[model samples]
Target: MTHDHDHDHHDNDLDPMAARVRALETILTRKGLVDAAAIDAIVETYETKVGPRNGAHVVVKAWSDPAFADWLRRDATAAIASLGYAGRQGEHMQAVFNTAETHNLVVCTLCSCYPWSVLGLPPVWYKAPPYRSRAVLDPRGVLAEFGLVLPEGQKVRVWDSTAELRYLVIPMQPEGTEGWSEDRLAKLVSRDSMIGTAVALAPEAA
Candidate 1:
């Protein structure tokens, strides 16, 4: 459940959205409008059971099997569903592939409509207004902020996620992974890669 991202400080600090959610839960529980235990169970499910690991599995499979990659590109919802990763926030899915000439980025311009079924709870930064607006207005700048500097000629294409549909970025396979197994490849797939803020890890890095 641990991640190596620079935002590890978030683990120590109470996320702003989480603080708001807790306040709302308190109000709802006090008014008897919501079950506190039920809410806790749901949170536990996402925190423990559903997470980036699920999305990594999908990414690794696509990397190892070209046919699966084609199917994911054609019918992401069904292809992802076939892997048992379909649920709320991931009903309608679209897979965008990262290639040598183009990089893909995902953002929910209106709100944080993320693929919770695959990637678990949305990160606090993902729901921030700055990321939402800038991702659409200046994707290259946003990637730079994430420390991902794309090639000069590589185009950045941003996808806006909606309530009805969500997007997953298929990062290009890294080099020196010619015959890597799916399990090993999955280790190289990070949550940011699927979100397109980063790319798959290099073999040595993994």
Candidate 2:
């Protein structure tokens, strides 16, 4: 490859993050801990995360109030907005509830279109090609990859997110707590749970 023209842009000229990445990559490569070619391959496959607090609140409310849950089911965008959380990438939202017989998984097959307002940021793996394809082709297998194994008779349904719409999974309420407070229940909702890669944690686990 030709580096003749690029050398004019020195390390100091690079952006802070770019400079740091270059430095780290060089250090790892020289130490034999990483291969530069492997690093390139990783970069080639990667396309493009946040805390799930907002989505957790939505899940908590759904678990605590039946009316809100019904509203979420009928119209997730307006329901989520009712709680004062609405913005770009979350304009059109759909809530898929996980039931005893069925599980739901969300993926953006085209690109990383996510419900940022509610779910925060999309995970890096969510933007990768393998997950986008396999999510729809083999959702159960994908869930198992995330360490969630559904029962034999249970079915897995994949929701494909697009530029205009996104999905949020409402996992079933865990057992052993009939009157758990919303705050307590919120703790049981993992980011992955709302993504449908896993179920809500049980009370003991929570």
Candidate 3:
């Protein structure tokens, strides 16, 4: 059941599972039961199986080890596999660096293209047409809107994602974490950092 597509255009073909989702939605809407339970089941499908928990492991590992973080920022796919969270879209991910010099941003132009292996199903706002259109055009403004105003000297590089290689942001380590172990450090890393909203914080700082 592992069907690999050789041609890029082949991806556009109807995924039977997705077609089934549409069919189910149509049935539910017709039956007047597109309620909270239906949504919950759909959310569970992605959260438990298709979304980004795998990618989160990479973020946690990177947060703990400076060397591993460096390796990850250089080649995320391999670095993640080094720690064993390699599968699905993450198999070909390219970690984008958001630093004092260049800040990276991710948005799915056509849809909410995200690194679900680590981050989980994108929040509703991420798929909103407004965020998709505006985040790319005005990244600084968007970040500010999200209450993430960088210092005046930093540069920003907003990256729009295609279906082929997903992206994740590696937030900078917080201060006061001088001699923390990787396990302790991992706890400080949050999904927000991977999704590029908040930065990571050390325990003492937190």
Q: Clashing residue pairs in candidate 3, if any? A: 51-116, 52-116, 52-117, 52-118, 52-120, 55-117, 55-118, 56-118
Error of 2 at 23 (Å): 22
Candidate 3, residues 2-55, lDDT tens digits: the string is 666676564666689999988998898889979757688867867576544555
lDDT of each: 0.90, 0.85, 0.73
Deviation of model 2 at 10, angstroms:
9.7
| Candidate whose TM-score is highest | 1
Alpha-carbon RMSD of each model: 9.3, 10.6, 13.0
**lDDT for each residue of candidate 2 in 1-206, tens digit (9 for 90 to 100):** 34566665755357789989989988988899999787777555332223477799999899889999999999999999998777644369999999999999999999898887777778899989999999998898898899999999999998888778888999998988678887888899998999998899988897
Worst 10 residues of 2 by lDDT: 42-51
Off by over 4 Å in 2: 1-11, 16-50
Error of 2 at 35 (Å): 40
Question: What clash pairs does model 1 have?
Answer: none
Model 3 segments beyond 4 Å from truth?
A: 1-45, 49-56, 89-91, 202-205
Better candidate number, 2 or 3, judged by lDDT: 2
